[model samples]
Target: MLKQFCEHCGEETEHKEVIKQKPSKYGKSKKEQFKAFLSGFFGGVASQVGASLDLIDRYVVCKKCGRKKLENLGDEFQ
Candidate 1:
């Protein structure tokens, strides 16, 4: 899903489910599933760490429409 922060409501939310390609035959296994889960977990942790370090930008959007809006609670961010 597309994760976006709602500046108007001061909340974090997601819009639609992100379509990710499923693993191929070579990668479709129990071990592979665990690896993928671990990878995602670590990636999310790293991202959070980076955000805490101010190494990334914070994006705000509309909660109901998933539009990028953070300026005046009605205007889109870009």
Candidate 2:
């Protein structure tokens, strides 16, 4: 978390910056995926982690108030 001023909270608070990934619903269903993972331990976990790294949306969310500010990856972080 980074200390930043939140306009909504009207104070400086901790903010969580997250690089959003593709939605889970885009491919195999959660229930089915879980069952498939049960077949292999490390391999299954590794595959899941590797596949989900396709990130898109980036957001900085305030901890004090649930407000989100969109950020671009190309911009330098101040």
Ten contiguous residues minimizing lDDT sum, candidate 2: 47-56
lDDT of 1: 0.47
Q: Candidate 1: list runs displaced more than 4 Å.
A: 1-26, 47-78
Error of 2 at 51 (Å): 17
lDDT against the true structure, per candidate, is: 0.47, 0.61
The global Cα lDDT (0 to 1) of model 2 is 0.61
TM-score of each: 0.29, 0.47
Please state the error at residue 8 of candidate 1 in Å: 24
Where is model 1 poorest over a 10-residue stretch in terms of lDDT? 69-78
What's model 2's lDDT at 76?
37
8-77: candidate 2 lDDT, tens digit per residue: 9899999999665434443478776665445334444543444323333567999878799876444233
Q: Compared with the true structure, what per-residue lDDT tens digits does model 1 show for residues 1-78?
A: 666665555667664432232343336788987776666556666544442222223444454766664222212322
